[model samples]
Target: MQMKKVKIDSDRCKGCQLCINVCPKGCLKLSNTVNAAGFQYAIYENESKCTSCGFCFLVCPDVAIEVSRKAKPRVEE
Candidate 1:
């Protein structure tokens, strides 16, 4: 089975928290510290359980979230 990963771009984040709310796995959380842009952004705490559903990425208006899955190898006969 392939695993999923979530990446957050703090620079582009606007502290919307939309991705946090949309994530079904509840892996996303808001950071207490602000970034260079002075915005408190969301972060992924529990990345191991990420489903790579892209819900967070889809809901993020700032386009800060990136979801990707590991490519599985094909079986050769």
Candidate 2:
């Protein structure tokens, strides 16, 4: 299985919700906890649904989101 990860820099986020709106997999959402800026930040909420599409990263005005994918290791026969 392929592995995908999304990292949201809470400190840099300003609760814009742009990343959440653009996420194709619905993997991102606003957190209840506010950052130091006193604004809710987007988080990778659904791990299994993420496809590393990079839409969230592209849409973020604050540039606070990062998306990554790791290929599954090969198995020897």
Q: Clashes in model 2: which pairs?
A: none
User: For candidate 2, what is the TM-score?
Assistant: 0.83
List model 2 lDDT by residue over 1-77, tens digit each. 55448888889999988887887778888899999989998878778887888898888888888788877799999
- lDDT of prediction 2: 0.84
Q: Which digits, one per residue and each the tens of the lDDT, describe model 1 over residues 1-77?
A: 54338889988998988888888889999999999999998988777788788999888998888888877899899
* Lowest lDDT 10-residue stretch of candidate 2: 1-10
Off by over 4 Å in 2: 1-4, 72-77
For each candidate in turn, the TM-score is 0.86, 0.83
**Whole-model lDDT for model 1 versus the true structure?**
0.86
